[model samples]
Target: MHRLEQQFIDNQWVRSRGARYLPVMNPYREEVLAEVTAGAPQDVDDAVKTAQRALPAWRSLGGAKRATYLEGFAAALTRRREALVRLSSTNNGKVLAEAAIDLDDAIACYRYYADQARRLDERQGAAVSVEMANVEARCYHDPVGVVGLITPWNFPLVTSAWKLAPALAAGCTAVLKPSEVTPLPEQALAEIALEIGLPSGVLNLLNGDGEGIGAPLSRHAGIDKISFTGSNRVGEAVMAAAAERTVGVSLELGGKSPILVMEDADPEQAADWVMAGIYFNAGQICSATSRLLVHEAVADSLYSALEKRIDALVLGNPLAEQTDMGPLANARQRETVNGYLATAEQEGLRVVRDARHRQLPSRGYFVAPTLYRDVPLTSRLWKEEIFGPVLCGHSVANEQEAIALANDSDFGLAATVISGDGDRARRIGRELRAGSIWFNSEQLVLPETGWGGFKRSGIGRELGPWGLSSYLEVKHVIGPSHG
Candidate 1:
């Protein structure tokens, strides 16, 4: 019903003066919610032009002034908290609780960057006490001109904030192209930009297809860097495109994370956290712990507990407060999940949890949370990225075996280890080859730590002061020559 057929360029809403528009649908309701203008090359050109024009002024501003601007962006975001949360739930099919957290996450990113930029410092080389007369060395970090950010629909607004806040805090301009599936948040964010008094062209959003929007933006000569968050397949494409232009790219991609339940871990608690990790957002998250590595001693009890939890999952409308899990984004996701389930059966894995498609009003897509036991490493459910409410159980003989199993995967974005003792947890956490390791908990990503992946999981980190470095370039200066 809503027409978002205008792209945000040069700090103003511009209708598709250059090209046609397309519909962005609500996966939960299986209906078109808004139309996005398929922003063309001209749009990217305009955004880059404005960004280049504003760069000198923005960079010249003091750190305190930049921090103030970031705070302004945060304040504006707070005013539309409720509306953004609702839109997130409607478009992405995440529950209200999750949607609210998305808005909170965005605010946190902005606030954190503001604080980081305020206290930012540069150091001059220490004066040598030796025979040196007068030699000076200095190192300073500076922003990398224009940044191009491409976000996924799964966590559109929140992820956008992660890239946008840091890049802007580091004094970089941005050209953001949010996913066409859930482009409303970017539109809403553009309106917030005006409220925040952000300098024109400092932050711009373009809506269009990959070739129409992403390729042009990434391949643009004026753009200094690129940041992308999405699936591995598309990530490869983005890398290739950026490589052609010889531009830097920060990629946050797919994950087949594992959860290792130590022998001493309480099965009841481990089972609860395991279910929450993968099935919380209908298991559409990249960091979903799809593989459960259980010590042989606790395997039986843990599997029993996990079976009970999945069996109790309520399959209903996401808007309903009582619904424990919603559908997998859309029909393609549903069919993909169902196909994995069918393949699980074909692979001879014992599926203990009921994964039948729960029929409701037949208006939206819905699928039950499923669990497969004794699934081999080669099984369909074990290897492929289901991106839905599907978890596979793998029983291991001991801690060593459990660690081996966890590290065997091609993807290693994140892993959760549930144990009673702190020493054991810390030891195992260190051994886990993951960007993030949660001990005695799951899926709690804080603002202070860095998050990314190893292997095919991702390229660079996000969150914290170090995250800002991703959008910055370091320069070394040697001066004060004695004549």
Candidate 2:
């Protein structure tokens, strides 16, 4: 039991005013890992005030100078990479390899955005109509003052790092509230930020439920922009809160992403990737390929191959080196996945693999992976974001039908098209409404590519230059005639 009790506000660890607090549970061991205070609406006021106070100077800092601090932060993270990996594995219930990769990704996000901030600046002007040379035309990428960030629990460290690194890179002071389920890492970052000379109040960390800290943060008048990653329902709530203040909002929401397997695709390779697409992180990823639609001609072979590979995967303690899969994050998540499995059976979908109830040590939460076939396009398991180790395979008559099925969902977060033919791959990838389309691959997030969703999936995006730009507001400046 690690005792950590502090709210990093204005660059110092402070105690919470609200009497409410919660236990931070380690999903791998189902033990009380830490005691965290639940920040209240009033605490949000302090955080926003702190960010507001730090904004002017922080935003005015030059790129090279900002890079110096970021470099220190990055180096600091590198030195503690091993501890981060262990904490991530213990808390997130992810395989150590996966947690290790998440930490590396955080480092990569920082290095990439640090460089971007140096190269890009908006305080200057640019060329316009040459005939009107006397006049000056320029665009500005100014910070949005205080940025409010609320990240999900699945990839708590990496995802929060996504918003924090870029928001800082853009010179925006931030008030970040990590999900209660996984707030330790973010709180830890708060400590590191203070030591790295992140500047008082430039970054604030709080722990609380959505109704407490998140709602207040979004609706806070001092917040100039909001960035959130969560379910569509919660995303809607945060957007509504931001709307109340008329602040800019960015979201990375729910996804029912599909993976299409073409007839010519390699069954050996495609099967493994498809299984990974839905099973990695125990299918909690927003971009997890929950739906698998294959060409009719190859559906049988592909399904069989996937079943064989998935069955051999090891699922147990996340700490073990041989563990390829781990338990759901908590008992509630386990119940949710189990409930979805029950519903899939009642909905007349054929459960190709009936998941067995596995017992874990009195310490942890665990669930066996599952695969369902013969599911109607409208089935709950097919259309909903299960956020667990469940995959539903459906047969498509042709490429066109596959594309239609992929687009049928209200979500448009991501899709994967597996095909040997470049033309067909391009066509399907293009037609998919998802923000991201993976072709002949899976489970890899690219730094340069833009990522977001359409419809109810999300607003704006995160990752790459796109993610960085979300923190900055565009402004046009006009100068008096020169010559």
Candidate lDDT values, in order? 0.82, 0.83
In terms of lDDT, the best-performing candidate is 2
Model 1 Cα lDDT, one tens digit per residue, 1-483: 777667787789877544677777777778888777777888888888888998998886756678888888788878988888888888888887878788898888889988887765432233333444576655677888898999988888789988998888888988989998778776777887888788888888888878688878878889989999988988998898888888889999888999988889999998889988989888988899999888888888998898778767776677778877766676777888878877876777887775774444466677777787778988867877788888898888888888888888888899999888878988998998999998888688777789799999989999976688898888866656562
lDDT of 2: 0.83
Best by TM-score: 2
The TM-score of predicted model 1 comes to 0.95
Q: Per-residue lDDT for 257 in model 2?
A: 91
> Residue pairs in steric clash, candidate 2?
29-363
C-alpha lDDT of residue 168 in model 1: 86
TM-score for all predictions? Answer: 0.95, 0.96
lDDT, candidate 2, 1-483, per-residue tens:
555456779988787766777888888777888877777888899889989999889988966677777777777788888888888888879889888888888887778778877876543455455456577766778877789999998998778878988898889888889988877666668768877878898889888887669888888888899999998888898888888878899989988999999888888888988987988888889999999898888888887897788778888888899998887887788898889988976887787766754443455677677888868877888888899988899888888888888899989998999998978898889998988888877667866777788887898988898898898778887776663
Worst 10 residues of 1 by lDDT: 121-130
Candidate 2: where are CA atoms >4 Å away? 130-133, 357-363
